[model samples]
Target: MSQYKPENPATEEEEPDTLLMQLRRKEGSWLDWAQACQTLLQRQKMTPQVIFEATGFEPIHQNQIVVGSQVYEGMAKAGASPAVLEYFGRKGSDILYELRILSPKDRVQVAELILNRNLNADDAHEIARAVKNYAQLRERPEGFGDHPGDAVAYQAWKTAQQTSDLQERTRAIGRAFQYVHSDGARQQIERLLSTVAASSSGGSQRKILPKLSVFRLEEDLPRLLPVVGSLPLSTAAWEQQITPEPEGPYHLIHSQGQQTWVALPAWSVIQSARDPVAIPIENRLLGTLLNQQIPPEEAQDPVLLVVDRAVRQWQSEGFFLIDRAGSLEVEWREDSGSVSLFGRVLMAVRPPRILDEVVAQDPWQLDE
Candidate 1:
């Protein structure tokens, strides 16, 4: 057995010795263990590895409990019901750990949902992801309300909207109905399911948009003419090479003589682009700006910047491509200045890498 003592024992009330005794004996509930581990780490300035070596608690377990305990505390602070609190106090550390991804208020709502539905760790994970993704959307879908159930239903509904298969759409709608709490939302989902069932019964097929496709800049051949020389090229030069086709589906254009293309969903902004172009981005600072938008696998690789030359009016919230002394760069500016405005950035695209696919296929293989 490893014997460990705190370097600077503060007050007797802290009871560092008592906490250590409890941990050593493996006494108390999981919540109590978590609280003790957190206190030891935060108040005693003890390293997790040291605590692990002494208490037989793995460092990864320590991390989960510490974070889970904090989330439980947040739930308590958010006015979680007594039954919900009591249920989590003894068990559900993994469920609480997943709730850490949500806000305090969201955590409470999700916790109650978990308790009511008797959901396990995997269900908690799915609910947390659904709620987080729904919260990030700029505009909430019409039928969905601001409830945990509504978030999950909205996710299912969105999936149903993007697929053309009747059976798949019906399954998605049924899933939405399973989680939907509000009567209005349930009714909407039922209507959608009915339509899908009717379509499956040899009725007029419901019209649904094609599933959103990921267009790789490297894989998809470029459609638009390439641009040369410094950016913010004269109006005549841009007009000569690129023409506005508002009715057309293709929008991606590439520079640097590279035949790269990115197909975007029918976004109004991309559709209305008079002069669209795609440029390879190498700036680290720009990458930092777009870090949230880029996937982790493609973080180190150069991203494709798709921009529309038609919209150049400066806005505080908008990012624009500019001609900075013969060099082209992307910047977020508060006000327009002498810097030439090349175009407004529509989106930053990360091309799929073959290396990622190769590694994913045989991740455990050793080098010969």
Candidate 2:
């Protein structure tokens, strides 16, 4: 029997294994792969560490089903993962696959299935081959990122990966940071970290957030937003390119598809800390607080929000929970208008009230 898997009509791709086949075809055909992955991970009761390992620590591109941390997205749009960036000193995923053309209706139907949680890895190969047969029966399907050339494939993958990293980390850091530190950041983070259990309900929207048994912080974190919308736990990392003088010493960080290299007017060093890791979270808040306390001109430097385990992943790159001593902060910039600040003071000064439901498998135990 041929272990080779058939192509998925939606993804317009074929592979030897059903998972890889569906995974290959799923590029550009799916609506939100990251959300889908989160849904599946939750059902499996996989922990955050599991997700971190299976998929590199970052948001799975909504349109791509990433395999091996390398992108097999649409034909001309193939890219690389950030994991490769850190090692290669390149900030993007390189496209290892070529682009292929896909029919419109077929693309929509296929992508929807993945986004809708209508297919699983086990049935993906059969489903894909069947879909291709159906699409071919109705009309011929065109391949987008496919070619017989291996060199072309390698270059395409490498280029795509590099391009994705540059585009994401270079552009989207501020927005993502502002997102993760908002009032409901913790809840939103916990939502995706929830246990990956199969849902008893139907409907696509119901499948998004995962169910978590528990999500604990290293310590108490501040809550700064009012109505925190749901947040996905996205990750990224980047090198710091600081500009001297007027622009002052700004740090460049990359994560996801975005990078944040905002200039800091002045920065403080915690006492005489040798390592960046030793720079305490509270030290980062000195600038914000001094601006409030002492005279304006005499105020100390603005501190960069630095978390111990995440300076590379969270701070510099752009996605992670952030809190300096008393308040949480995420940097957001606008093409027009002033920057928008999203975050809240810690719960110590004021308590936060939230409404959450706990599912009881044994209802009788509660009554007894």
Candidate 3:
């Protein structure tokens, strides 16, 4: 067999040993070192452990440099200023690593923020997380613009608004003050601070409800419906027939013969539900998509999908429970064409696993 050679063999001047030596001596900027490490791993086929043995660099440090370098390249490509590039070229590997979670445009914006504010790694982490979370919101709250500072301030402001605790609200207000960029955003925080101050004086305090309420499977009881298979009810049956009970909020539905209870919260859409029902997830493909939202072990267990019969119109990309031929199934609005919407899916509820039953199945743990 002919001798195997690398597709792009390195010249004597650009050999693997030369790269290793440069890394060992710390001969160039941190960016250059990062690139050299990447070249060794990808082109030279050297493992991080082998490189660590050759040079004093640890594996974790290697990972940081490689990833941070990519983030730096993204910043540069996004037209980051020369000062910003120069500042990061020599140091701030940890800060850059935290920025890898951001998009290219966001990376440049945040890098400039870091440079301008003289922020540390921890601050960089907070800024990146805030920006990412803001980006994922379906609609931005009024008065908060799209700037990096605005994103941070918005998060702080939101926290302040939602929290009823005195200390937590104070901390959130402080953070909002620190990050508020625009005058409008500043005014918003000021109003929130004023509320806190007024509340301290024993004025009529506005109570903010907690955003999430925890419901226990064994403790709480709601309306119950025993269901079989994935189809809960036909579109006509829900729209023409189902009505709320006079006793209380009608929400929970049980899967017949299975330890599952599908519950719907008193959301505005759900409260308006004429007759909502719980459908057990039996389709494999549908179950796979829904599995992304739940724990992996629960993938095989039945997922109770709460359907709101009140919502029949296609508003967005929400998953709708529809009637396909005689069979009821879950389908995304984007993929389906002109089908009658049985109900829009309010949420998917996965029942908590019975760990005691699992422990009983282990033969080694059985008592004599």
Candidate 4:
């Protein structure tokens, strides 16, 4: 027996191995428990409502993040690539829902359209229709002859997509008739026009023009009376008097917001008053041509003089007071390459706030 028996510490110490074994067992047990819970969830009898009632486990409220996460996971399970999943995860359920309904071809087209630019849902829908119709027309021999509606839809869609300017888009859509010729297609075109008109008519009413009354302090009236001044006070007279020479039939389009007074020479107040997008191309081109025809000597100084005289009248004698709720500033824009100016003066009169700033006294003050 004789050589002393070797004692091994590895055999003696079981704590570490036992602890690891115990942990593994616990983990396995936990996984089994999770599987059981998942199975229960899959059963119709174990609905979320039932689970809540039976175990008081309240369901998580589906906020945007939760909804998005679930959609992401579902898409992932359906074999969508990581990139595609992440891209769509940023859009809401409405867009995803719309995509899910489309054929793979349309889905790809729409996804590309969305990825390339900023578009609203309506725009996306329109562009999608255009894409689909365009595809159909390409396959058909008759083209717009067979499907005039598709021709109109495609033209409107392409114009809206390509042009950044609204007026240009309207002009382009108006020209859609050149592409489509069938009587049925004409009806579709008419419907589109009617829709546009209805929406325009239903939009917010124009802002009320402010009541302007100029007055002089009772004490200053006597001293200022001798130095006479002339200002076109009424809105109509203001438009007439202030119009630049090389004469335009300029009229004021009074809207309450930023572009307070858009003075258009030839177009109706409605045409001028609305956004540039609303104006037809013909009108815009006409306006530009008219502007170019004016001689520089005649065009440059008249409108500025009008504003200058008005400001002077307001400041004259501390004798003038304008108790209105807005401010006025003149702005001029030259077409990108042309020498002519699109003259406009902004007047924003917010109700309930009167802006009164001191106008510096003119150097040549004539004393009574």
List per-prediction Cα lDDT, in the order shown.
0.73, 0.29, 0.75, 0.37
Q: Residue 135 in candidate 4 has what lDDT?
A: 58
| Model 4 Cα lDDT, one tens digit per residue, 158-269 | 5543554446646766766544556655565565555455545675432334558996443211110011112223333233333222212332233323322223223232
Q: Sorted on lDDT, highest at the top, how do the candidates line up?
A: 3, 1, 4, 2
Name the lDDT of candidate 3.
0.75
TM-score of each: 0.55, 0.14, 0.57, 0.23
Q: Which 10-residue window in model 3 sums to the lowest lDDT?
A: 1-10
TM-score, cand. 1: 0.55
Candidate 2, residue 355: lDDT: 32
Model 1 RMSD in Å is 17.4
For model 1, which pairs clash? 253-278
- Candidate 2 per-residue lDDT, tens place, 280-335, comes to 23322443433445345433333334322312222232333333343334432222
User: Which ranges in model 2 have alpha carbons more than 4 Å from their true place?
Assistant: 1-72, 75-108, 138-368
Q: How many Å off is the CA of 77 in candidate 1? A: 1.7
lDDT at position 65, candidate 4 = 24
Give the lDDT of residue 185 in candidate 2: 34
Error of 3 at 97 (Å): 1.0
Model 1 agreement with the true structure over 1-368: per-residue lDDT tens digits: 01112233223267777777777787877766777787788778889888877888888988887778788777777799999988988789889999888999999999999899999999999999999998999997777799999999989988897788777887888889889988778877887777787787899878876657886454333345233333334444444444424233344333434433445544555545666776666545455676646455555776566677778788778898776555566788788877777678777666565756666687576343
TM-score of 2: 0.14
Give me the displacement of residue 160 in model 2, in angstroms.
Answer: 44
